[model samples]
Target: MRFALLGVAVLAVSLFVMSGQMGVPSDLPFPVQVAIAGAAGVAAWHARRSWWPLAALGAVTYAWLVVWPPLLVASYFAGRTLGRGRGLAAYLGACLAVQGVSALVGEARDGPQEIMTASLGNALFMALGTIGLPLAVGLWTRARKETAEERARRLEREQIMRAEQVRAQERARIAREMHDIVAHRVSLIVLHAGALEVRTTDEETAETAALIGGIGREALSNLRDVLGVLRTPRPDSPAPDLSPHPALDDPDLSPRPALGDPDATYRPQPTLGDLDRLLDQSRALGITVTRHDEGDPRPVEETVERTAYRVIQEALTNVHKHAGDAHTDVLLRFADGELEVEIRNQRPHGHPENLLGTDLSGAGWGLVGLRERVELLGGTLRTSTEESGGFLVSARIPA
Candidate 1:
């Protein structure tokens, strides 16, 4: 709407200037004058795209018919568009040449005496009005536009910096809480598990206690890694030492291998290849699980495998919590360009309430975290109750 109004204003002003010029004596016919006025309006309207063409036409008309308005508009656009070098110099030179030509034509008609007096004064007035004033205003407009864009860019950069600062502070706070609370508790669980393993006389009980202690120590080590990342100054920095802290060491506990050690027990990220071990752990807890594979097995990206493993891990954990002793079916379908993981458990033999009680019924954040993990890999996770009173958790991930 603003541009339409501007076009209308330009046309009106062009016609007004042309009409006023018609009163002055000229050899050009009336229709020719009207056509030139129409052309001037069109040139002014399109001056933003290429002002040089308008400048050329305006220079000719200004010299021949004393049409100054179109030339003035063209000069303004030229100032806004042209650089302050060869382009601007050439335009000023052309304007000077046109002024000289106009003066010569006037002298030829009105004689040297009038040219020296009135022509010189009129030439100065025309130069100031047609070139100087409009050109200055156009340059000012260009400067203002550039300033506004710079300010917007600066504000955007500041906003990003502020957001990063807030995220860093939040990460630090979480790390502190986990270190003070979770780390301490897991350490104690590891110590107790170690003591249990030593005191047990039965071979199976000692083995189970050892497994618990190993799992607990691995958990503590992983928590240390998490805290290390949160407390790091930058993401690209070297990882902190993965060895257990001296404070967490216990004489009853066997030494776990440090990261980078040849016999390290901890794997930073688990993949689908680790699914067997996970299944064995569940089976050891007395859950009947059957595994099925569909389609030809193929190598998948490590990240995809990790997310897939997590989906199944979280699902089986849910099974243990809510559907104890349930027969669970684990399916891995490798399709053309995607991998599908489905874990479905049949109805438990006993009431879910009587299974493990509420002690194992976690805070329900595991499924939420699993969903986020799957979606981050451009995948989908779904959980629903089966018609057979079973629970189904499914995930589809891009390979």
Candidate 2:
């Protein structure tokens, strides 16, 4: 309602300013302009739905009085904001009603000119008030609305893009954990299964191998889901050669001879006592993994031993790919209540470091997870490129 009064005051002041432009007389008296303005405000204040109608009437009246008429357009624009569609119609209707009043007023006057001439001029002025002003105002409203919606949609799209980026990061992290945990377990299973296959010929022994194979198949399935559907691509594609998810496939355990019953997975843990024998075991696979020990002997926890063994196993697995023919050295040290292990390798001259057929850059969190495992046990882990074109990982865990 207050807006209606402001609209009226704006219209009158504009008319006062442009009075010379329209050549309208100011003899209507200050009190008269105030009364007309008040009446228009009263009509519009409570009836905002139809305020444009009354303002449109005010514009027509101003035109008949020969005052600056452009100011009438303000009320039309203001009414559009205060009210919506119906206000425009109401404003137009009110303008016509005011024209009727003007005709009656002309009939009562004693001007020398014919009333019909003045009446026609008043009607033309009414058309400009109701039609010209409202048409332009409605168009302005439409354009404003369109721009606002575009901004809203743009903001929404940006939000969706940010959310998708976050989701991708989370998926990568999940995929990393799955690959690390599953790979470590599967490697051991394969190692032990190979052992069992060699030393056993009994039907029961065959049955166990079948079970291990079953487990491997299940692991492969899990890895498939956690990783991407397409791990590697066709030769024709330019995409990267990487696993989309973790490997759940069975571990490679084909080397076990059918001679010894060394069921070591769920029994007394495997440790350095088994290291000497294990090196000989890996050598049979045509992979050279030399071990070196230094520093004084120290007592360590069983968990640390198992974790250490698994770390080396993975390192060797990576070597089988990257340095199948590389001279590899495994160093273990115990000193000052700490246990440290360092694995370093130098590929044989002119041999490809990527002999395993797996992409090494894809080995990101494989080492990171191993490092985290070590750190969780109050340990420190470090990996860096060796000067001799080799790679080294050194880990130290408190005893």
RMSD of 1: 4.3
Candidate 1 contains a number of clashing pairs equal to 0
User: What's the CA error at residue 253 for candidate 1, in Å?
Assistant: 8.8
Tens-place lDDT per residue, model 2, 1-399, is 566666566456544633433333444666776665455555445444554455554555554553333335445555446455776677557555655655565565535212431568745754565455665676687678879999999999999989977876776677666667765577567556656766788867866665665455544544443354232222233323234322333224222213343331113445666676656645655567889889877667888886777677667667766666677799999878788888887754576543443556776567778988888999888877765678787888888
Query: Can you write out model 1's per-residue Cα lDDT over 221-338, one digit (the tens) per residue?
Result: 6676577677765655665443354544443333444657642433367788889999998888779999999999999999999999988988888887778889999999999899
How far residue 182's Cα lies from its native spot in candidate 2, in Å, is 5.1
Give the per-residue Cα lDDT of candidate 1 at 260: 70
In model 1, the worst 10-residue window by lDDT is: 352-361
lDDT of each: 0.76, 0.59
lDDT score, residue 344, model 2?
81
The candidate maximizing TM-score is 1
Clashes of each: 0, 24
